[model samples]
Target chain A: MGKWIELQAVPGARDRWVRAEPFGGTVSFRRPEMLVMVDHAFLGQRQPKSATASGRLDPAAPYEAHLTVGHRCTVGCPGCYIDAREDGPAELGFDEWQRVLDKLASLGVFHVALGAGESTPLAFLIDLAHYARGLGITPNLSTAGLHLTPRLAQKLGVFGRVHLSLDGAGRDHMRGRVGFASALMSLRILRAYHPRVGVNCVVTRASFPGLGRLFRMLKREGVVDVELLRFKPAGRGAELFAQMDLTTEQKRTVVQKVLQLARRYRMRPRLDCSFAPMVCAAGYDPTRLVRMGLAGCVGGSWLVAVDGRGCLSACSFDNTAGALSWSDLGRPGMMTPFTNWIDQAPSPCAECRWLQVCRGGCHVVARHLTGDFNAPDPGCPLVQAQA
Target chain B: MNRKAKTKGSVLSVRTGSNPNSSSLGVDVTWLLGGGVLVGLLTMVGQTLTRWALTRAKSKHGQMD
Candidate 1:
């Protein structure tokens, strides 16, 4: 049988927002807010998008959202990014969360990536998922999987995908540490609850050695999907950054390994936006990356993360950039400060050929490592090469 | 020769020694091609309708996350 091209709605996205793809992309907007992610754009079949379209700003609502319900953790992973504690920003109560959800829905936001220090402990996580599902807002939850109970998983089964946070294959990173696990047990529990389970691996230097094993383990568990996240240099990670972060060579090697595994597994190999520099380092075509909507810095465009207090920043990782609430979002010339540098690459990036695609990698990573939010991503091969 | 061709009024006729089997075969081939095109178009219409129906049904309740 021949391959059939599908027109699918990006989950929890506007019903009108359709993503038609494979390798190929072109995120074209007919109206200011309507984004059509289709291969026809990459196929050069779309009507010419505005030459100066910027592909960044939209006066309308973001298509995706990241909402951290609370910041209290039962099983605090080593180097916890949010620095959750009893004193940290508390979880929003259901009513408060409802209001935030209401505002997002009113803005026509469709998908919400739900998380916290540990989502399972939130008493109303299931209710929140049910509520978001009721509103046609997809809730993609991620959790530190150690404390998950089957009853909780069963309740969560109704909404959408629940990603368990697992680092490396077995016990590569701090196996005996606080709350992090290999997540194999959580995977087993969730697989029984829902078929759409996936893992989120926080990529570190040790993770490089186990990419093959991690993918192999996931594949054996009837899981083919995982998102590789860069280890942010924040919270406890700030202290562990020098010890845990990948070196430039390791970054390139892991990228190459991911590509090899992706081909073998026929998987998309989902890498976080911060991994864009690594992808670039692996010698992938810049134009292809752009056409693929693999443009590294989409925090301020496609999605933004809201903290428990309802402050909307560019994404989950961007903590320092000033944020705006729903009321302030539509101000005359307001844009997330972190992404303001998206088009206007800072310093060294301004001199690079692939400036537009990589966008100097991740801002938060730079801020934490180089003490300058505007510094070029330290993991980027170009930064090291330029040096 | 397998067959000889002659034209009368811009219509070419193929003649074999005793049977005009090639001419009948040509007619059958034309009909086959025409039927194939008609079937293909109908199938496309049917597939499009099915997909549209599925999408409508999914919008009400779909399998996704």
Candidate 2:
């Protein structure tokens, strides 16, 4: 067994040795003086020395935020997670969203994912992206591509990243009759100007079979980065959950296939944190899986979500977190209370083997499945097998 | 210096000798060749064992703490 040690300087000239043990490779370091240490292992497995040395984040700052700009969407897919409707909750006006952006910037959030209902005005999205850029926050836009006009695409050129949603080649059936064609046409147009366009594919049982073909199609289009969002039972998604959710066997197959395809095509595929358990189920080390950035569940900790109505959530799918308005920023703690609330692991999660990596899976998904946020994620094969 | 001179003289004598196929010298050469092969095998085995152990350790424990 290989042994390694890191000595961190603490207050009072004290040195703390963070030792990596031989048997379990467990790392232990405790020093109040250390502002941040990047040496974190996932599922009791140590990462590469470079990863451990470079992984640093300020404890007080959020790494990312998903900001919903509007509540109306045009691509009314049956499985839309937000249950976004034409007549859904009114979106925060441009001025209100600007205040939220300022608050996020003040909180030290570096990246903001701007998404809206499919029907959101393109003008609002462009203005908000520009505003976020002015605040020194790198904005990432997620869109259904229904309204991705030449003017809007040109305006969105300033975005750090743009995620165009596409499920499979069967766009008509997967995303709606018009969504697939429109998204593909927009992607073609955007590629002419934008260099960092990525595809966000929602992995569901119906879409799983066509993933390989879709990946090939994406690679042919010169797109190298694809983020696979796991299907969650939220909003309008719950209605189709029974038919769309992947079985354990299917989950294993899909994960293995995706991993193989990613390597074969030299594509960078990032799975949502909800798929961490699938990696564990595939008998792979979570640490290695995390090197692909697919293992850690950063919800409520590294990232937070704000709905169109100014409601704060641990993630876009998690709406249980209380309302966070512009007025809340005047308080001393601001969003700390909400961040802390969602960041705290439940008692049941302590016993999980993948606790360090998976962070007990998505709390919203757990609550949706078992009717308790504290319950282990029902999607996890380990949790399912236990049950 | 005397030992080296004596060994060189002995080798010259053997090369010029009538009985070139001496059993003693043949045995010594065979023993040296066999010893070399044995050492080579042992070195290979040692290297293989060390590699196996390291791989097993990594797979089981991931990394040392």
Candidate 3:
């Protein structure tokens, strides 16, 4: 092998690879698609270590961590959830992230996705990715690509996954007003550099209509992986929530369409943890869906996020008022305040049949709408029907 | 899951992922995407599943006989 990253499959340590059956042994992520015949396969892999077992907030630590490099964004989508602006704060520096990566590696975290309001300006983004990889943690990226140049794509050659943000197939749903042509060019350039490139579609009522066309557009570019992310109502310009939030019926429709399209196009699709309730509501076997990486409210469990200010939250959308800094909770044995976002779910969700699968839907969204972090996802039809 | 499986006493499996620099793009994932940092080409590299399991157990628990 000219160059390869070797990842040991430690129990409870999750990764992008299918660390379970239908794939094979969870140990050694030598290659994504390579096959190795072991003398005898381990009967089974260990489940993720929960607080009940370890009596610690994070038993094995989160398998994946997200790093928000900065908020300095040039493309100002009217309903931008992060409030990212051209002059937004650039709080975390290069050294701070390196230290953060060191902690995660020691804690057994194996995957990280780097997102920036705009990565083109951040010269160290690729180097940061390389640093995480050196620690056996695979690093991915999500960018607005408002100003992605061919030279920049070539520089990003080391990254295995680089998802470009797009609202829809064309001008009608594209955010950042980064016109349709500009978005297409960014996709082409990134695809040429890293063909495994994916698209992060911000799902809202406004963008859902053109989703079919968007899927087709991405497929034409040889893009095979896609993730449907909920359009969060946070940050500035959130006043547009009423116009953008998916309606009750629209939520189910979007989920249905996403699954249908995944099957039709032979695409590898992922729905954000917040979309778990809707996905389960469609009468599919949630356990079987595990093959597709479906899980509910992975925050405080399978994943966590660190922002530019060095704050760590259960999920990136978490805005629980007070903050948890890397200097504070980064230490082992400290409990993140986000624990209640999972352990103390709303009464309805706790009593709901899909409780374990959804973890009461999205705690951040519930807190944003109901002022109660334990409240069920406001968009959940299960809660609506019961109401 | 652009796969062609052959099972004996040992198990052999393949999913879909390719290098961006490679000219061959015949991979089609069955149920997963962006599996991991797969660096090997489509060429065969045969190894026993027992080694894979022991490596996993050793890594997960710090060392085992």
Relative to the unseen true structure, what is the C-alpha lDDT of residue A191 in candidate 1, on a scale of 0 to 100? 90
| lDDT (C-alpha) at residue A193 in model 1 | 88
lDDT of 3: 0.61
Q: In candidate 2, what are the lDDT values of residues A176-285, reduced to their tens digit?
A: 53556677898887787686787777778877888888888889999876777677888888778778888777775766687677766767576666776665665654
Tens-place lDDT digits, model 3, residues A1-387:
313434344323433222332323323344542323221223233333421441222223565677777877777777766677777865778898899888777666656777777633645788998887777766667776767878888888667677877778876555766877888889898888875688777788877877788878878888877777776767763577677778888886666687578777777666676777787677655433432334577665557777777877776677652357865544543444455555566667777766655667766677777877667888887887778
Q: Write the per-residue lDDT of candidate 3 for residues B1-65, one digit (tens) a residue.
A: 22322222232333233212100011222333223222122112323333454446456655342
**How would you encode candidate 1's per-residue C-alpha lDDT over A1-387 as one tens digit per residue?**
112333334333455433332322322221121133322332233434542355432324555677776766655566777666556665567887887777666655656777776533645777887787676566667776656778778877654566777777767544223333436777888899886677777778877787888888778888766777777776667888888899777886766677678666654356777777877776655544443335566566556667766666677666653447644533434554555676567767888766766778887788887788778887798788878
Best by DockQ: 3
Give the clashing pairs for model 3. A37-B48, A37-B49, A38-B48, A38-B49, A38-B50, A39-B49, A39-B50, B1-B28, B1-B29, B1-B30
Model 2 stretches astray by more than 4 angstroms: A1-58, A171-173, A286-295, A326-349, B1-65
- DockQ, model 2, C-alpha based: 0.02
For candidate 3, the docking band is incorrect
Per-residue lDDT, model 1, residue B25, is 7
Clashes of each: 2, 9, 10
